[model samples]
Target: MATRTQILIPIGIAAIIIGAAGLISIPKDAKLEQTKFPMGIVKIDGVTLQVQIADTRPLQTRGLMFQEKMPYDQGMLFVFDGEAIRSMWMLNMQFALDVIWFDANGNVVYIQKDAQPCKSAIETATCTFTNGNNAKYVLEVTSGFVDMYDITENSKLEIISI
Candidate 1:
């Protein structure tokens, strides 16, 4: 009886391992719609920018975390549900980026260019821009995107998220 029990235990363990392996085979399709949001086109200094609006918690928390690259003329617009002292950081960013803050009037209130990605020994807050006040939206783009597009203070940022 003891010998039979030992053999059964090994077989059970093998079966469990096989079951776990099957469980791990779940398909992983890239959730492209996860990044797509109600967006609009806005021209800054005659350059058009395609943007995705983010106005919810999930949208705000996942702000461009896994994106491999953003086009020079494209960006992600983070729309806050309410007015606040908005700030941004580059935690999982693979490349440098620029953050532009907009006030309630849809005007560019602050622009932080060439934002450095987070490093083990480096702090991003040191390089962050805190010039925005009661901002309602934040825009993220590639490094030097603002300068390349000539986006500056008083630049109009149209939103179709409403």
Candidate 2:
């Protein structure tokens, strides 16, 4: 017959080995690479920006989630099929952002400035979602981008290339 201690000792060691292996396999920061998405060029209020186009549902869902930070001259542009009440959240975001919604004609319909990130589990579960006013496109940039370039509801977005 086997002793309880003999069986327990091996189980404990196996647990520790499994735990360490799990930790080693996990990435410290799985930052989203820009090259994974198609690139676009857009201009808003005379400020030109290089943007990542999130045109598909999968790409839109993963927008800026794990990125540590973004340059002031760069942004993510969400393209939809038609104008509607689009919504966005900051779940898993690493930094704050300024979100802008545009109509089909490229006219700004709504803007959320300095939208904060949701870090903890509770915060992520309760993260607030911002909605647009019948918008066909959405743009997300570094927190201060809107104020820095004086982007307003009257501002228009020009897609130089996509």
Candidate 3:
């Protein structure tokens, strides 16, 4: 029989390896939720939300695709270089969301609410949704946000950042 010291040593090493591997598979939602990103306060109608900025290309591409849950009071804001028709797709998203577009002055230009997750039927080419409107910014919040908060095309936004 192997000595107790030999068995215990192997068990501890195995645990360490397993823990490291588990970190690699941690869901993006959990990691991103904990990350420190530039945050801004957004108000539409009487509702308010704190949002993360996705101004970089990599972050814009990620765009809440892998996240499973977004807090009601928190969201992600996408900033573009100019006002143009920008389309969006629900490729790897795992939860429903509401996408609201804004003009340069932060006025609501268009809205897409309750956009379903396409991770299950991800191979289908029908997952894209767009209003084909010109917008300089996009805000993605939890599902039902538009209806729940009564955010309409004429609603205004007051974004303040520190």
Candidate that would win on TM-score: 2
Root-mean-square deviation (CA) per prediction: 12.9, 10.2, 12.7
**What is the TM-score of each predicted model, taking all chains together?**
0.68, 0.76, 0.72
lDDT of 3 by residue, 84-106 (tens): 88776675678888999898898
Order the candidate numbers by TM-score, best to worst.
2, 3, 1
Every candidate's lDDT = 0.69, 0.82, 0.75
TM-score of 1: 0.68
lDDT of 1 by residue, 41-148 (tens): 665556678877666765665567667888887888877877789877565567789888888778887888898876521344443456647788888889988877
Candidate 1 scores a C-alpha RMSD against the true structure in Å of 12.9
Steric clash count of candidate 1: 0
Q: Candidate 2: which stretches are off by over 4 Å?
A: 1-35
Off by over 4 Å in 3: 1-36, 120-124
In angstroms, give how far residue 4 of model 2 lies from its true place. 45
Q: For candidate 2, write residues 25-143 as lDDT tens digits.
A: 43443234442889989999889999999898768767887789999999999999999998786766899999999999999989899989876433542355557379999999999
Kindly indicate the candidate among 2 and 3 with the higher TM-score.
Answer: 2
